[model samples]
Target chain A: MSAPDRFAPLPVTDTPQERGDAARNRALLLDAARRLIAERGAGAVSTDDIAAAAGVGKGTLFRRFGSRAGLMVVLLDENEKAHQQAFMFGPPPLGPGAPPLERLIAYGRARLAFVHDHHALLSDAGRDPQTRFTGPSALHHTHVRVLLQSAGTTGDLDAQTTALSALLDADYVEHRLAEGATLDELGDAWETVAVKLCGR
Target chain B: MSAPDRFAPLPVTDTPQERGDAARNRALLLDAARRLIAERGAGAVSTDDIAAAAGVGKGTLFRRFGSRAGLMVVLLDENEKAHQQAFMFGPPPLGPGAPPLERLIAYGRARLAFVHDHHALLSDAGRDPQTRFTGPSALHHTHVRVLLQSAGTTGDLDAQTTALSALLDADYVEHRLAEGATLDELGDAWETVAVKLCGR
Candidate 1:
């Protein structure tokens, strides 16, 4: 889930009334967390490492985010929002001004790439189906539904979108990968399903 | 998984070397395990309950299945084999007597229903993607691959098969159900995907 909404609630750092120093401190820690996650993966980075990397004490880390998981969720949400914005408003097929069918295909490719890149954090955050489906996934589904409508397709768009979203599930993607299915194979299969459904 | 093969090497009782009494004792415990799982759900049932219900000692239960999780895996394997047999040999549509498209639709419905009925046990047994994707899922994928071939569709049948299988994944199905998608909705979506993929 990309929204801080589903994750154990946003940390105290997210409250609008935070002091300037506290806000900067929160940003510093989050920046450090994101860089460390990118470098070594989400599962490998610890709160202790994050605090050390951010040049802060562990107490400040805990005080701001409550726990390591909370920090990870918040940071992941940032990534999710960025992905959503890129597709919704950035440019080209993934953004606006492209054919709906093209956007749909682009969306699938981008989402598959997203899951592959951020699987560790996504898997850890999406412990429940609700969280897993509601946050970034819900946004993705709505995007697909709109694209399908714009593509001049008919029939239960709700169900269609849900079924389509199922293809990009992080756990499913990871499962396939763990079983030796390459990213290229997943992308090919996704293209097959997407093109068939879009009637292109 | 549909195979008893991947789940801890096919419990001791499955070997032909078992004496009549040992076979009977194994049957008793297994029957008890199934009953308890069906009645109260797998999560609520324990080894003690199965042992007591089967009129055996807890040690016998462990000796036969190794552990509680092991027992659940074996019990689930039994269900998977039954499902596999029903689809592979039993009757029209679901069995070998109908068109591949019809069989494919029937397979989706049967698998969805199977996951619904056994979610508790299957979820408990399949703690890893390796086990979940390798066993019964492998057989199901092969079944779908053959159906896709028979329907005369071309284009990476292996990858196409994998994508279609993702639509029926137990975790995906359960996730949709948890997110308020009804079984009917899931079935409809499956029909849409199957018919579209099969071009029937």
Candidate 2:
């Protein structure tokens, strides 16, 4: 199934009516933040460092993202959108062209990789229980549900989706990694689950 | 298989050498707290109410459990022990003597019930990521791993156990419940996962 409008990228919260210069500044700051975060880790990258890296003043950085925490959230959202694009529309396996079960396995591995790479930024985002089930999470749930249905798995799809998604949760993934499981091992384990659920 | 020493109840941290009367007071306070929490939700119950119900002064309640948060932790620990005893030592299905896969299914149902009944308290206790993988969580992992190994399941046991446990997490269960899934539906879905993993 093709990616539907409901699966659109997470809405960027910046004002829609911003001028061209403001939009450019926003993109520059986000790019700089992402680069700095990748280079020095999210915790080590300061707002000042991001502003200096973007060649913008500190005031512009704060105005763009509100606070350090806000910037981290936006960064996560941006990354989440890229990930959504990959599995929903990019190519075979993780995208639409592969078999349902294959796509499901690829999705788990890709999602795990995303979480592994963005662990610091994600952990720092603070999982607010109230907001955990909305937005990007809801989209992920829908995507998985569709795949599960497509795979011809019988039983309660909603419950299965929740169970599967729980395993892919960022915090749960981090907990497993901390407990000494490699990302590849986690991905393999998830594939086992996906295969089992598809009753192959 | 019998419950091992390692799966014993969570260690109660109260001073072991307390006077007989102090022990009595401690039990009284805990009983009162449990009764009050059952009658009124955990958030609605208070240390003062617990003290009054136990026919003790607030000072004794404080000295017994340290503080409100301390009392909640001890309460959760006590409940966790009872749950551990049931699955580890109690009879059949959830305990011993049942087929490994049946036991696994029963374990998931029992665990979902535990989290369902203690939803407010568990959520109130807060999920600290650092301590999440230790203590009771670790014990749960070992129990599930042992069950999988005994059932002759193939693939990564640790990873599989972690994935399974993630679905049974209190927060994830609560999230599903809030999203309109019934406890029975959750149990059924879990049974499906267990059956598939056991290759039944």
Best-matching candidate per DockQ: 2
Candidate 1 residue lDDT tens string, A130-171: 354555556777898899888876555665665566667677
The numbered model that scores best in TM-score is: 2
TM-score of chain B of each: 0.71, 0.69
In terms of TM-score, how similar is model 2 to the real structure?
0.71
lDDT string for model 1 (B1-200, tens) is: 66665766644437888778877878999999888877987878888999999999999987876667567777778778888999999998899989998888888888889988888776666554335555556678899999989987766676567666766756677877887988877777877777777765
Model 1's CAPRI class is: acceptable
Candidates' TM-scores?
A: 0.70, 0.71
The lDDT values for all models are 0.77, 0.80
lDDT (Cα, 0-100) at B15 in candidate 2:
60
| Model 2: DockQ score | 0.39
> What is the RMSD, in Å, between candidate 1 and the native fold over all Cα?
7.1
Worst 10 residues of 1 chain B by lDDT: B126-135
